[model samples]
Target: MTTWDEHAAQLADTVTHPRSRWRDAIRATPRHLLVPRWWHNDLTGTLLLDGPTDPHRWMRAAYSDTTLVTRLGSLHADLAHPDDRPPWWPSSSSTLPSLIVRMFRHARPETGQNILDVGTGSGYGTALLCHRFGDQHITSVDIDPYLTATARERLADIGHKPLIAATDATGPLPDTYDRIIATVSVPRIPAPWLAALRPGGRLVTTITGTSLIIGADKTPDGGALGRVERDWAGFMGTRHGPDYPPRLMHQFPHARDQDGDDITTGRYPVLDIAEAWEVNTQLTLAVPGIETHFETDGDDRTAYLLHADGSWARAHGHWTDAPTVHQSGPRRLWDVLERIRHKLNIEGSLGLYGYRVHIEPNGRCHISQGGWTAVIE
Candidate 1:
């Protein structure tokens, strides 16, 4: 039998440096207690795993550096029956240990400084923080009452107690902190975050709909200035309620095969926009609020792009071949994608990384690199 301590040590060795300060914290924390039950997706469908029933598999999963989804739609795995199948989209998860450590390293918190942990999902990250710094310097918050309450109990069982609260991180926070790190992604930096950050404080988070991780330091005028990190990370977007709103899936069916106002042979092969992180990021910056879906049957592939403003585009063809694109509404979504691809081909890179970011107090972001600039309002 592999003891959990041995597993923890192995996990620590794999994810962190031998001399890293976080190694000890990772070794000391027991991850299984925080996530006793979670949902696992396999080829057939989503499956629920009950830890106590299978201790060996539980230890392997809990200690491994992989995210475990704990909630689907509004249904929590804890409250669900063994036979129930919740929605496919994950609402909350215990983020992988390495990513948590990566974000912490970006913040670079020193001892005796207060830290706010946003999106208290499994409380595993809070436990690590308590072990690294004292519990007195840690505070974790989430919008879901059940998540906070359950996390508080689990944390207490592990002999750690940090201030755990049910509050919306996008709105007013509970108190001031020297560093704020959010596991959930936000479309824009909320104004309340700037006000809650102490002078000379730092904030580390990811922008929604992109894999860009931002590390910003507070400015004198209650704003922030920083740049996009070279490393990329993706997180679930912040939600005010139990689950995110319905996706634009209704538009997908129509766009799948219907003729559009304009049709043409695409200059490039069909691309899965969701999987191409850099291309997806650039497209989000160029045309915000677009939803994408991709499907494949045999060697033929189809990709659809839909927006709330009655705009849509569909491209379909064999893999590696130029697709036939159909587009409608005010914007030509496929043309926009081609223009972006054209730039990528011409420049050899998108230059999204290392872009300078200037955030106003109201959370409007002015991002630029060289002569190019874009605003996130």
Candidate 2:
């Protein structure tokens, strides 16, 4: 066996910034060793991603830049014996290599500076961080004790030791940091995160509702200053415990089996919203709590954007009646979406990408794009 080295190098070459220091970490680190066993989703549940059936594909996938989830709910997918196949929802993972590199680019950590890494998922990124800086300069935290323990052991196996804290990262950290990079999306840049930075320190984060990249600098008054939307990054929300909250369908009575409009045909396939960053971020700004879902039943395509305001829009394209649309409640979802897309198409860009993220001591947050500004609580 040539080991994963040969293929790892091949994968490294495919990255956007081939010469970046972070790419070198991806190349040097044997990812399979960090995640020997992992999970994949099935219609009913999650299953291990590998088996003895095909060793070569397993080797390739394990070392490639692709992501693999290792934990879900309280279950450790990697702990499943060879004979066991368990189903699970992804709760933690080793993020894809490209995303990690983007985060490092946004973090812009100085040489020898102390860093706090939130959500130390498979410790892959942590290892890369330690490799870039020294062992004493890294501190990783996760809410799950098992995750923290697993990452700590993986770090030791790689012959590096960084402090690991098994606590929620939304609150205060034990030590102040020069740079803080969170791997999970947050509702807002938590006050503790801003407070933990030394003066002029940087906090790199992504807003959960919008996936906007925010980089802030620490000020003297325990408050911090920074801007959002300079980069594009996203992660699952910061989970507090073994299980994340149930989906909104479980909370809202109308979310499931609603009487509004059940016979809607959609105009788009479940569009990968990431593909439409312009429209996505634009509408995310105009409508804070709205979530869009799309589906296609062959020719009958449907698009649905739902909001907490009891407003919903359903458009069925390809219909003989010119794509029937049904909307109910206070606001019009389709109108807002079309307006956002039209603005982007006319301007050739959505200003959200050009916005800045600012933070305050009272935990106030604001975003400004294209002369438009809004506050985030």
Candidate 3:
């Protein structure tokens, strides 16, 4: 049987180059310790896997370059029973190792710089940072007290004593830092995060509802300017409390099969909006706060778009065929999706990558690329 050290070495080789600065850190840290148990989602439901009970499977999962869901809703996998199943979406996860390396590369932290690691879900990222940089220069924060406490203990057990605090990342941070890298997504850059940046500091994070990774340097005007990275990544949105607000599930049934106020045949084949990251990003930028759901029964596919404002749209059809769309409420949801698809088909891309980003001191972001511009408030 292969040991965890061997697995870590293999993972290091897979995710980083031989000369990569992160290679040593990845190989040194024991991920299995940080994530002793996690939830594995299958076609049936989310299942809990305890590391001690199945060491081989646990080692395989922990060392793999994959995100491990550690918590669903308010229930941590450690506390869940064998048969326990939470209906909510994943609220916390140990982000994939490669993406963590990518975000750190974007931040470009140096030896003497103080770093803040936001959303310390499993403390795996924090452990890597502690290994690469000294523990004294690292501070990690998460909203859940249980997560922080457990992570702090687990990290200490591994001979790392970084400051791990339980605090809302969207609000005031504990202290200022030269580099801030968030594993969790935010609706926009938090004003406190902007205020907490030291002079000549930089930040790397992803926008909520999109797979956009942005890196920005502190500006003399107390703001920051940067651009959307070419690489795409997604993270769970930051929550202020134990769990996120209930999903927009209440609107699903009505939008699932019922006739809508407006009906039409879609100009294109039915597509899973959530799976089409770029198209989904465009739609999110065009209309914020929209929720999407997709399902397929055999060859018949159905997609639904719902909003908190009581607007909904459903598209149903056979695979690769034009869908019959039903839309209702104040705005035609299907029309918006169609327009975005049309733009992608004509332009060949959404052009979100490399877009210039200007963030105000108050955290409002102005993103522009050529003739296109949008603001996130």
Candidate 4:
């Protein structure tokens, strides 16, 4: 097999663009050092460990561009020994390169502007910023002190020393910056981010409500104005400290265990959630706090939707069942999902695409769509 560096080189060659300057930075920096310890998450919680003790497995996992979860649910993956191969989902990771590059484009930092990076995952991004603007002009923050410390050491190993702080970015940022980029998604764009930007400065971040990428400039009037980049980039939502709010096991106790009520058969295989963002987001506008899950049992398929208001719905059907049938509660959850799906199919897509955010001086956010038609609050 080719050496890991060879793979990085190949990817760098293929992805050349105005955004490709970071490619060289990616190739030059040793990503493995920055992510020596990481964690993964699962339905139960996070599993902490040093991934793949086998030298071969370690090298392959370390070099691939895919994000590796280093920490989850208070378990640091780096801390786990080699003999232990624990099953867990990814909680935090070195985000995918394409998404990272799109974000850099959104920040639009000039050669002279100072930059701040929130969520110093692997310090890979910090090095990229430092490569362009020098370490003096970049500041990186993470909620975990160990992550910041590890990032600092590895960054220094590469001779890049942008500030890596162990602090909560949701609170006051350490300093004002000409550009701020965050790798974590937040449900709401924190008000302090607007306060931290210098006039005309840009803030590129993911809006938490959906997988929306927003790029806005700090106006002299104080609101930030920018539009969503046309891509889907998901990062773990920001955590106040070591971990985010735990998954509510009881919220879906029946999800994996008991048979659900109003359970009709399902016709579709498990669909990727990313594919439903537009319709889902649109539906959320009509009905908030509604979530969905899908499952399959060889011959049959099932989809579930739950709302905090104690309403739930389940749809069960197979190819044989056609005509997509299902059941619902006091509020019909399946109807809402199917309606959104149908609306998307009719419109050829959902309106959640290509949104623009207008942050007014008072911190109220106004979102708009094509032709800048603002979404009413």
Better of 2 and 3 by TM-score: 3
Cα lDDT tens digits, model 2, 1-377, are 86687767776787656667776776777667677667776665656665345667677777777888887666776676555554455678889877887887788898879999998988888888988888899999999888889888877987879998899999879899999998888876788887788888988888776758888778787666667645786687787767787644334445333545434433333333535765776677677766776666666655667777778766666523345566666887777776666676678876666566667876678876566787777
Q: In candidate 1, which residue ranges exceed 4 Å CA deviation?
A: none
Whole-model lDDT values for every prediction? 0.92, 0.74, 0.92, 0.69
| Candidate 4, RMSD to the unseen true structure | 3.9
Candidate 4 or 1, higher TM-score: 1
lDDT of 4 by residue, 1-377 (tens): 67657755755554445456677766666666676666544565644445335545555666665677776556556666545544453446777666676788778788888898999977777887888788999999998887788889889987998888998888899999999899997766788888988988998887554666777889988778877677766677787866655443347666544554554534333343435677656655556556666677776766566767767765555634642444434677666666667766678877644677788755566677656453422
For 1-377, candidate 1 gives per-residue lDDT tens digits of 88988999999998999999999999999999999999999868989999999999999999999999999999999999999887679999999999999999999899999999999999999999999999999999999999999999999998999999999999999999999999999999999999999999999999888888999999999999998888899999999877798888674567876899999999998888889888889888888888888889888988888889989999998989989999998999999999999999999987778899999999998889889998887
Clashes of each: 0, 11, 0, 20
- TM-score to true structure, per model: 0.98, 0.85, 0.98, 0.84
lDDT of 3 by residue, 1-377 (tens): 99889999999999999999999999999999999989998888778889999999999999999999999888999899999988748999898999999999999999978999999999999999999899999999999999999999999999999999999998999999999999999988999999999999999999888999999999999899999998999889999988888778564677877899999899998888888999988888888998898889999999988888888999899998988999988889889999999989999988879999999999999999888899987
- Candidate 4 TM-score over all chains jointly: 0.84
Candidate 4 ranges with C-alpha deviation above 4 Å: 1-7, 37-59, 83-87, 254-275, 319-331, 370-377
In model 4, what is the error at residue 26, expressed in angstroms? Answer: 2.0
